[model samples]
Structure formats: structure tokens, C-alpha cells
Target: MNRRFVSKVLCLASVSTLVIGTMTGCGSSESKATSIAQIKDELVASTGAMAAESVFSRGVYVNYAKDAENPDKTYFYVFNGDGTGSIEDGAADTSNYFEYKIGKKDVTFYIGSIDPIEEKFTVKSSEDGYVYGSFEDGLELVFEPVSDVEVDSFNATNYVNEQNGHDFVYHDANGWSVKYDPEVITVNAGGPMTTFVYTAESAGTNMITATYTVDKNAEESIKELGKALGDKAFYTEGIFPGTEDVKGYWVVLNPEEGTSGGYVTAMARDYMEGALIFEMDGHFGEDEENNMLVSDTLAGIVDSLTFETK
Candidate 1:
């Protein structure tokens, strides 16, 4: 199989806004926030401003609901104790650094040192703790606190290979390994299966899951699955690079041209335990133009994967 590689570089644009008259005092949950200026005025007149500082600066916050609506997009924002902060947009996979000013009721974000965007700070209590909610452009955006370790990984320097720009590195106990960028993909490892997810902007989400099987060699296991899937898909058998005599298989789904969602590839190879089976699936909406782009990105990751028999 031929492997295709993909790389990304992002550029940020500045946006500006103006603030009107300031309002003062803490409003109840029943009251709707109008503007950041009013919220700032209230902070100046009350003692709650101090509390707001602690709340905003205590931890990193992420747009929890963005991934559900647009799997390819998620963003994070955090307030530094010194009125400085940053926001990372997952869609573009870029970080925008900024200086921030906190008022009792809202925080103003200054991007590019010129554009001042004001957002109302209404802290809502959830079962998991407190989450900050803001109303912007008719959408009630909610941000929840994430762990410090996860936030640390969001930094570009924290990745596996800084010079090469690879963001994540994983090695299983069985001696298999893989490297990929966390900004464009994420992994969930547990039980007998590991899942990798990639969100393609405007196209859809791609998920690849691998399950380990003990006592079954790669060729035998794949053949069994291929027989069951028969004619429903196309299959190719081969050997992975750097491997000796061990065999592997690749299966691609066959569907109509206008199919909304389907499997892209299913493959497996011999490993320390027995075999590591992988199934790739794509979820595309009405827009499918980016399907090949998403597939190639995911394929690049799989190509980087290496397996060893302990």
C-alpha cells in the first residue's frame, strides 16, 4: 500500500468590537445578561469582583458541546492570574494569544492587542462543578473546566516530536507503537480495544477502532472475518513494512456513491498477543467532498503505526 502524508499550518485573523455603558450589580439566574459594560460597572460597585477573578483563573475551560455539533471543532480558553490568556481553536488547530481584563460580571478578550471582544460571565453550577456560560451571537456557549494534564498536552511543545511536529506518541505493553498529532486526532485506550478519532472540518468525523485477539494469528483471524464479510467489501492481504513472514489484511467497504456513512478500511496484523484488528469508519453529513482528505489523514496515522511481538 502507498502511504500519503499530510501537514497543517494555521493563520489567525483579528476581530474587533466596542463596549457601551457599564452596568453594575450581580443579577440572578433569572435575569439575562445584556452587555459586558453593564457587568463591569456592577463589579466596580460590588465586592463580588474578587470572587470572579478566582473563578475565571482557577482552571482551563473547554467548549464542551462544540464537539457534538461539529466534531471537527472544539476550543479551549483559560485565564492567567496576570490578566493574560490564550484560546486554542481545534478546527483550525491554532492558538490565539491574548490579554484579558476581568470585570465582576464579564471578561473582555483583547486579541492582536487591538480588537476587544467582550463576553458576559455567568457562572452556572453543574453536577460536575461550576461552568461558565456566555451568550454570543444567539448561541448559549458553555465552557467547563478540564484537568491540568489535558490542558498541558494542548501545548504545542508538549508533543512527542517538536522538530517533526508530531504531537502524540503511544506504546502498548505488547511493544506496538504509534505517533500522531493530538490537535487533529485523539485516542481512547481501554479494555481490549483502542479507538482513534479524527474530525475533518466541514466533512465529518472518522473513527478507527482496534481490538486485540489472543491465540489467533493475524492471517487466520482476518481470513475468518473476510469470509463473513465476503463480497460486501474488497480485501487485500500483504505484509507490513519491517516485518518478516507475518501477514496482514486490508478491507474497504463497498457502498453506493451517495451513501451517507460507511466503513472505509478494516485491517489486521500479527502482534505479540495474537493479532491487532483495526476497523475504520467515517461519518459524513451532506458534504462529502472532503472524504478522501479525511481518509488520507487517517491512513497516514495508520502507516506510522508499528507492531512487535513480545
Candidate 2:
């Protein structure tokens, strides 16, 4: 797994004071606090994350503050076991030059022209494989051991600024973007499914969606896809280019009378930890042929898609 994937989702700072991981005290009678190397050694040893059989798939999600609605004002950091990551400290416009390395509970920082400095962080809590702690300044930190299988995984890096300071544009960790205009679009995030709806605008009431899956096995995954469609769709084994590792199909339904495009779904992209699904559920305007309007639109999006995983 020599992949360099700094997740697009960033773990943002929030003010929910109800800390979540399991807790421990950093102070010991002999020294009150431990050294950086001692902390990392104890942490990795405690979690057994250094082992090969451990299921600590999801990386760490830490925040200095609480979660905020306005992201530009929020700051956070994302860490992975691959020895790679990033930090967003509310610095806008100016590029913040910094590099970091995380070893067990030990973290080293190399900022600007300054020499690399090492710091020891404590694991105040640990739960479900996640560790929660903070800096010497009591900057609340939580190391959420996540599974890529989980859809709404928290981390500020996961949410991309699709809106280039203009329209409320969006594209998810998954690879699809909506064709509908952002102004008229409404997003519903906290659902069993993440859905984007377009009301009577360009493309005539279009809807885009993304679904996450954790089925590492092929047979079980296909079975789940079948359950989702529930027997009304017509699917053709279609090739989603650049997705050679991800075998998939294009599914569509009979368009309604007077509607230009039909419901289109690009089912199953074998991704990083599991899989993803994309569906365009609306009339995609009139193209040369009938169904091509929807299928072609999906195809175009897929072609322009690129994943940032190493």
C-alpha cells in the first residue's frame, strides 16, 4: 500500500465540548508528562497498530478547536499511517509552508527555515481504535481511527472547496459532480443517503447522489448493488474509462413521456478502501439520441475524474 492519499476530507475544529474518544491522564507521578519517543512507543504498543493484523484502516482526525460552519475560519489536521498528511490553520491566500511526520504518539514538525522540532502529544482517550488528546496548550485533539467503509467519515480534509468563491459548486470524495446549476440546488447531507436535488432549472430537476460501500469481496458487493436497484433498471455492461481496476456498468430506466433524459447510474467504482456509486436521476436535456444525453453526461464526468490516492 505505497499510496500517497491525503484525503480530500479535512477534520475541522468545532465547539461541541462533548469529547468522544475513550480518556486517560497524561500526567504521571514521576514526570507529570512523558517524552515524545516514550509516548509514541506506548501508543503504538497500546493500540497494536504497528501489527499487520490490526484493522486500523481509517487514519487519524485531529482538531485544535471545535467544528464550525464557516470552513475558512476553522482549522484542523489529517494524519495517515503512510507517513503523509496536512494542516489547515485558517490561513487563506498565503501558502503555509510546513511538513510533518507522525510516529505512533510522536509528531515532528518542519516549518519554514526552522530546524525540525519534535513534540510529544498525549492520548487523553482512546475508543474504537481512535485516540483523543491535545498539545501542551490543551488544544483538544482526537485521533479518530476510521474505516473507509464509513460514508460520513469526519475530517475537514474530506470536504473540498468545490465552490471557487462563486457558485455553491460541489463534488464529493466520490468522483461525480452535478450538471445542475448550484444556485438552485439544495443539498441534504445528514441522510441514510447523501443526495443533491436540482429544482426546475438547467437540466430540468436533476438529482445527483453518492453512496459508499465496504464490501471488499466482489460477490457480496454486486449483491448489494442488486438490492439497491430492486429490479426496475436496465443495465448494460459499460466500461468506465481510467477505472480499469473498477469493473462497472451503466444503468438507466425508460424515460418519462416528454422528458429528454432518463435516470442514469454509474454503479460501482472499486475504490481505495471499498467502492462508490454515482447516479443522475433526472432529465439531462436533449442530446442527439434519447438516452445518450444521460449516459454521455455521466461518461464525460468520469473521463475528467482523477483520484488523489497514492
Candidate 3:
């Protein structure tokens, strides 16, 4: 992937943690400890109905903590029921953590700042049995399972040529078709993943835009292809945009003219089941309709994604 895209993704992931920390009341040592203990208790109580043997096999809940000086810096301690526990940090790793028995099965919990730019918390098991908690309201999380298909089985040609092949379409609230195009290419390697790309075209009077989706597992292959395309390929960066969904690193790139706007926004979610990526790029033009059309097009595609198990 492009270096710029990588940077953006990482930045978003980091911001997410900060947002989560604030949301969970990690602003002070006392509040942080209290919130962490309460959350752990909730998990234990929710899983207590299961058999003791099953419970022992499951992990124990440990108190979560935040940095003594920096309220936004949070960490979680997970016990293994046998008196062993592991510590997780918001700065280092934010993806997977210890699993606890919620019912008959063991479910993993993740923590990160994902809203208001600086809050953090643990997600609870929703109706689907998967944890779906978020401190920020605007951000969405999609988790899909990795398919059994081998990475070599993915055909880049077929992927680029599909009828709906990485297409982005925009519609107005009035039900009018504003603009539509399929201009981006996406390739996947193995697990659940997604990517984002932006492209635009100028019509006689308006500008048309398209945004592409790339899977997380597809990063390796995409990077390779990008290299083959020469120095124009994407690269990773240490900074990201926005406050919610902050991460340790991000991926970013400035697309060539006629391709898309100078800036592109991208993010990736690595889950036990699979992974998903979200991206957004705007089209620049004098016409307001063109800009609106491009924004709506990218937003629509992003809103349509759904997560499923393999």
C-alpha cells in the first residue's frame, strides 16, 4: 500500500484508543481504576452462569489501568483464572486481548479510543455474541472471518474486472443518481480485509468521483503490485488524521493528478476472524456539485459494508 495510506491508518488506530480512554473515564488514576474494575465485574457477571469447569477454562477478569500522568494512556490486565494475567496497552497493541467465557463459548474483548478523539472502553457482547462496543458514535466496526481459500487463488485480473469491481456510486437525498464510476483496484491475500482509494473525472459541467475498497489481508499483495508500478506506490506513515479510531500507525499516499484528490483517508481493522479497511478521498474542483457528489459516493460505498464469518 502507499506510505501515506499506511500512515493514515496507523494514526486513526491510535486516535481511537485516546477517544476510548476518555469515554471510559480514564482521565484520572482513581476514575480509571474504578471504571476498569466495574467493566471487569460486568464481564465476570455476564459470564458467571456458565459451569465452573468451563469458567476455569475461560480467562479471569483483571483490573484495567491508565497512565498515572497521562489520563489518555490506558492498559488492561487480564487474568487466566489460574492466577496468571497479561497486561495490554493502548499505545502498543489494540487489536486482540484475553478471552472470557460469555456463555458456552469464549469471546475476546478489545479496547481502544474510538470517539470524541480521546476516550476508551471495552465492548460488550451484543446479540450476535461478538463484542460491539464503541466510545465514539460515528465510527463503525466490521469484522469478517478469513476464508478457507488460499492467497494464491485470488486473481487480480478477475478482481479488477468484476461488474461491480471496486466501484463507487453516489446518490442524492432526493433520489437522483449524481455520479458513478468503478476506477479503483483492490487485491486480497488471505484474511478478511478492505482498502480505500479515490479517483475522479471532470464532466462538461460537473466532476464525477469514485472511492475503492481494499481488504486488510490484501495489504501484502497490494504492496507488491504497488512496487511493481514503481516509486508511485503507497507507503506507511507514523501520523494519522482525525481524533477517533486512532492507532499506532497509518498508511497514506498522495495520488497522481486525474486519479483523485491530493489527500486520501484509510483505516484497517485486524480481527481474529478477518480484517476490514475503510478509506475516503475527496475530488477537487470549482463546482460544488462535483465535491458533494464525490463525498457522497465514497460515503455510500463505506456505509454498505457488512461483516460475516467464514
Candidate 4:
């Protein structure tokens, strides 16, 4: 696997405690504590009914801190009732899937195509409505249950600042638009997908491909694209500004030492009778710093995205 792609997928698994973004937490020494073992036992006895009723099996659970190196990043998880979920880093613009089957003493998380990580989790107390948990590896996470309304508030407050702070803006006739820094970015229009290129003077190139769909739902279409990219494909989802149903996913393949064949971010939204799908591909170079530069630049372009269904 390419290091760049790994970096994106593992952004949610970061080891940090800096309070950032819209979440906050406090230490709890007086709250009740339990282990995954106890929870698993209860779950098994209930024949999966408990899963449907458990708060951990629904909505978004966000970490209280952002990545120390990338403070703008927001890490979170969405655990579905079917033993499947996603690890997400919002500001970093990355997400991936994880499958888990509760064991006697731990929960095994299979994220993307990576080797499974077995977490011996000890659930601590909830402070200010934020749940606290510690893993065997000394990694502690403080999670707050976020509602859809809250998510919309967060997106509106955070991403609104990523507007056209660039030298140029591109508006497609297809009811979508993006802002890009003309210093290092160029646009190529006139195709099914509009291409934006960012070339590092000393390293490699990064690209974003934008398009839409009119026949299916956004989430299902993005998942299908991820599966078509192969089992190694990573998945991502999020709400974009001006839209509630816009979802995104991506995949990386043909990895080399410091670069890869392609790292794609596939996103879509259902509008009226059709859907709008947007995609971004980053082809980074051997220079780790330059790779990060490209990633940040492309992330900004994504942040500046705006669209209309009609």
C-alpha cells in the first residue's frame, strides 16, 4: 500500500489529545466503567437486538481532539448496526470502512484492506455527554454523539471559509463550481469530467476529476465505485456545503515507494430525479512534504465546491 493512502486512512487512528473543531471533552474518574468483554457478552445474549438499540451502533461519534500535526482535521467514527462502520477524518478529507465482530475480550476492527487491529477496549465514563474509552495500546479517545442537525451546523461553520481565496474560479454548465489557486493549479474542461491539475515544481502532480450522476442515490453509487476499484479501495463519506446528501469515497492503487498509481476521492449527491457525483485523484511524488502540499491544496479545492441540481 502507498504511504500517502495509508496516511489518509490512518488519520482517524491518530494518537493525540489536542482539543479542536466542534467537539470538547473532560477527564472522568468518577463515572462507571466497563470493558468490551461485558458489552460483547450482553450483545451475544441479546441476539443482535442490543446492537440495534445501542447508542454506539448509530449516528456519528467524534473524537474530542484534532490531529496535532493537522489541527484542522476532525476525527470520527460511524458504527452501523450490521457490524460495519467507517473511520473518518473530516478536515483531512479521508475515510475508510471497518468491520468488527465482538469477541470475548476485545473487538477486532478490519479497516479497508489492512490487517485487522484487535482493540481491547475499556469504556470509561461519559463527561458532558462525551463518552471516553481507552485501548490496550494506551490510546484514549473521547467521543461525542453528533446529530445530523449538529453535523450541518459544523459543516456550515467550518467549510464556509474555504471559498475562492484563489486567483481563479471554474463554473461548469452542469450546475457545479470550484475555486482553485492558479499559482500551481490548472483547469482542463470539456469532457465527462473536468480535470484540475496541481504540479509541484520539484516533485509530482496531483489531480481532481469532477462529474455527476442522474440515475442513482449518492451513497450507493459511491460505494459501488469503491468496490469497482478493488478490495483495497478506501471509502469516505461526508456532507458538503449547500447540500445535505453529498457523499464521498476514494481508492488508491498500484503503489510504489512514495507514490501510487492513483488516489481517488469519489463523491456524489442525490438531487431531484438524479445525482451529482464528484471525484478527485491525487498522484503524489516521492517527496513526502510535497505530497502533503498537494493533498492540502486539493482539499482546499474540495472545500470550495458548490453545486445546484437543476
Winner by TM-score: 1
lDDT of 2: 0.46
**Could you give candidate 4's per-residue lDDT for residues 67-168 as a string of tens digits?**
234333256766675788877665544457788665433355677757756554445433334555556765666666766534222332123233324245
Between prediction 2 and prediction 4, the one with superior lDDT is: 4
Segments of candidate 3 deviating more than 4 angstroms: 1-230, 233-250, 255-266, 279-289, 296-310
Please, what are the lDDT tens digits per residue for candidate 3 over residues 1-310? 3344355446655655555567664366766566656655544444422322232232222222221232332333433454333444423322232333333433333323232122333333222222233234423332211223233232222222332344432222222122224553232212222233334453222221222234334354335434554665465633222223433133445546675344444544343333334444444565668666666665655445433221
TM-score head-to-head 1 vs 2, winner: 1
At residue 109, candidate 3 shows an lDDT of 34
| Tens digits of per-residue lDDT for model 1, 107-162 | 56676546756555543222243444454544445566666434444543232144
Model 2, 184-208: lDDT tens per residue?
4566764325676654335555666
Leading candidate by lDDT: 1
Residue 251 error, candidate 1, Å: 2.5
Q: Give model 4's TM-score versus the native structure.
A: 0.40
Query: Ten consecutive residues with minimal summed lDDT in candidate 3?
Result: 58-67
TM-score of each: 0.45, 0.37, 0.23, 0.40
Q: lDDT of candidate 1? A: 0.59
Q: Look at candidate 4 and give me any clashing residue pairs.
A: 212-277
| Candidates arranged by TM-score, highest first | 1, 4, 2, 3
Candidates in order have lDDT scores of 0.59, 0.46, 0.37, 0.57
lDDT of 4 at 302: 78
